[model samples]
Target chain A: MLVRRFVRRIAQFLIVYGIGLAGLLGLKYVLALSDYVVPDISLILETAKEVIADYIPAVFSTLSVTILGQVISIILAFSVGIAGRKSSWLGSFIRVTAYNIQAYPIVALAPIIFILLGDGFISRLLIASMICYFPLLLSVLGVMAAPVRDIEHFYRATGRMTWQLEVKIRAFENLSKLTTVISGSATLAMAGTIVAEFVAANAGIGYSIRTALYQSDLAKIFVALFLIGIIISVYQGLLETVGTWIIQKTSTEASSHE
Target chain B: MNKKYALFTYILLFLPYSFLCLLIVTHSAQAKEHEIRYRLKWLFNTSVAGDIYANKAGYFAAQGLQVNIKEGSPEKNAINELELGRAEFGVASADQVIRALDKGARLVVLAQIFQVNPMQWIYRDDQPEIKTLNDLQGKTIGITFGGNDETIMRTLLTKAGIKEKEVKLSGVRFDFMPFFRRQVEVWPVYRNSQGVILQDKLTKEGEAVRFFNPAEFGVNFVANSIITSEEMLKEQPQVVEKFLTALLQGWEAAMNQENETKVLAAVKALDKNTDARIMQKQLASTRGLVLAEAEAKKIGAIDMPAWQQTEAIMLQAGQIKRAVQVEKYLQVR
Candidate 1:
């Protein structure tokens, strides 16, 4: 199942990438643009072959930060979401703060971050987390705040309901949604890391993209995009597989108890 | 009754035909203006003062051209716009031009804008003056890693017999905090625009700063130059010549010390965020970069050797796969 899921994800990404590339090539031909403007497929393939080895390490550097940031954001989002689930003043405040922070452009805040943290791994990680955190937080908050009242009523009526039990009931009931949100946030995490690198950081695929832009090599950029897309797809596929396993196992255990 | 009906029909037909003729005449008159789009390399500042001046001063109109001058950013590549049939002419740096040419872009260089490349390093006066290239040892220098500044600096270091480990290189962004905080001893800036602003800010704080120009150390990587696709030059040679003549004239007038105030006012209208004082200083610096005293008469002359040297530098730095004989593409009017 894992292998099939992973293969499916890779195939989906390849199809999307191919179509997008075809569209670009179509436009290039229609406009009769030079290779400098939009490179031909052969040039892209050649450049990809040349740059893949170097870009792999750069992509891994980006992935490491992306994974780290996503994990940090997940932990923070769940913590904040739980605290804010009660619809109390503190909860409302947290929601307002998250909305405000998300509304504020990350690029505008990047200079302050660079000033404080410098353009190192920390800055990239922080920016990535900040970008990926808010949406996750909002989703988690929505799930946690909306009660699974039908099932919770039984526990409440029996005087056996605790906060932990309430939280677990809501999370389990909305496992599909929670998993989808977590999986979706992976893309945001990767994008955030790339943006951080593009804006300031010296390392990663984003930096390589910036270099290619300076040299005006569209082929290198296309190659980088393919690698990033494939890697992120594999990651998201893994997360979904894990989520499925957990869901199945929990359902089986609950049925046995019944 | 039949005669009256026939007269009314003739009057209606005549009115429609007359209106059509008037419309055609108006359009033809407008077409005489020869509308074209000219994309600048960067934003509206002293760096593009001459371009803005040419439009504002009616130089283009005098040549029977209706030019729309567009502002450019890093993402808004003029060469791309040209290939997509959006822009007729554009200002591109030497590296950009060479890189595009190497990639099968049929572009031609019409004129060189900055006689002296404005890309230079700004350093605090407190630091030991870099009289020689060897003086750059052990200092943390800021470079936009993928930028032309990196290529130029690396060449300088190599020429000085300095290894990469001998000095620290920091990646630069839009912020100047690192340089302000003294974390970076030397920072790269365009001598006319950012250089003027940085100098002004430091001078106000009672800190003197000096610029280290690579040209003085025998590295002359060319800056922005006027470019157009080969098709435009080949098909409409007359239009190209007229455009070049008017542009060069506007640049000459804009660079003249006598016309500094007028040029500053024109630049100020487009770039209101800049301080009036800074604008004045920036224009002065631009005048120096655009035309040295000896070359004052030749504002837009294509510096062939500079172009060749720029190509050579890019090739040596591995920015280009092979040598693009840039001279063959240069159409010096």
Candidate 2:
């Protein structure tokens, strides 16, 4: 039954995305046809190639930062989240802090961080970490705080070990939210990194975009945005697929017990 | 023996890393400790001769000065920056230093860069609408506030007996092509930059702007003077002298035909898209404007009457109400 529901949702996602993509592609072709009579399509094509090459590195760099940021955030989130959930007062402060940090993206922090840390990977790392960490904290808080009463009572009644109960009850229950937050945070980290680079960077995709903007090189600008979009989409899809497998495995274990 | 070996090995491993950290720190530290700070008229534009020319010629370096060449906003508040001590010196008109002296700021002129005003009023050729100063009698002229170029123009107008109330007013040309294409009729463009550009094109086609030269007509302020605080003049007179000596050398190198390639290369490095020959032509214009007729006269020297005449024009132009004694403002070298 769950498989059927998941498949229907997946189909809906694809249909919506496909229509949007196809419409954009159709519009692009129509615009190209309506261009000046002696079209310099090759010039634009070459420009696109340069832009793609520049973007590939930024996409990869952002992915790496995002992954590091996500991992750190997860560890922090879970630890803080569990403690806060157990203590009602602590939970409110943690929740408020975590929610506010979502707004601390790279553009906001890059300049000050550059001044303090002296501008390089360290400044960028802090920006990415701040953006990525917030989502994980939110996800962790939601699940740990909202653990179904029946599951909690069962664990308490069984006199099961705390760590074991944590893995089975809270972790199992919150897997979907955990995966979603991790993927979202990673993508957000990439965006934050780009904005950070734009302000005080020697080089990066952000720097490339900045220089292009300074000189009014529009082709390169579009190219950078397109490649960033492609990278994020691919990562998101990969995360969701992995998440579905985990969900399927957990469900199968539950069915076996039944 | 084992502990000693471990200690030695650790030092060897960390030695290069420590050296690299030291290099980075030293480099950035050098930037902050620069003795001289120069606020330019524009952010990294090659049109201004001082920043790029000074930087390129190693003139500042020879004076034991590390110049932090910062960008300037459209304000030409270079005088304000000088007064504020955001920097040791700034670039503005010689007339500005004179006017600003009486107004509670003690800005002193160090050296004059452009003796002839490389400043002019440019109008579109198609605009048969503006043929003379009388034709510009009611047109909106875009002007940058607190600048000598606009001040000089207004004075020339008053001398021609044109009233300020008679003409329409607008902001300076923020957009280049639109201004040139007659969105606005009159603007103060740098003679070496936009004025020579439009003139050459028009002259090539045998038509030109009915330009009223400020120097020839009425307003003649010394254009583009290297300025410092009056305090810097008294405190570091020797350092100021050395700087002037270096600048004279730079100007000679910059103006001569033999150093044309070197200057153009420097120009191109600062602005990548600048056309080489056009830039050289502009370079020629810049050199020509810099005491072209007055080279036989003392270099970096100003005549007292010329300075006062320029200031009086500004007063008539209504840029400033107060009079500045030219002798009190000038450093008699």
Best lDDT goes to which candidate?
A: 1
Candidate 2 residue lDDT tens string, A1-258: 555544654555554444444443443354321111111335346668656765687767766666676667668877887877764677798887777766655565666776666446666666667766676677777777776677777877888748557645887877777777776776776776676666654446765676554323444565676566666666666667777788889989989999
**lDDT of candidate 2 over B165-253, digit per residue (tens):** 88765535233543545656777788787766667766786776755456665457766667777777889887778766766666667
What RMSD does each model have against the real structure?
Answer: 10.3, 22.2
Fnat per predicted structure, each in turn: 0.60, 0.00
TM-score of chain A of each: 0.97, 0.76
Runs in model 2 lying further than 4 Å from the true structure: A1-258, B1-34, B60-68, B74-77, B80-85, B124-149, B164-170, B196-211
lDDT scores of the candidates, listed in order: 0.89, 0.64
> What value of lDDT does candidate 2 attain over all alpha carbons?
0.64
The iRMS of the candidates, in order, is 12.0, 25.2
DockQ numbers for every candidate?
A: 0.25, 0.02
Model 1 Cα lDDT, one tens digit per residue, A82-191: 99999899989999998988999998887788878888999999999999999999999999999898999999999999999999999999998998999899999999
Q: lDDT, candidate 1, residue B31?
A: 24
Question: TM per model?
Answer: 0.93, 0.47
Steric clash count of candidate 2: 1
Q: Show pairs that collide, candidate 1.
A: none
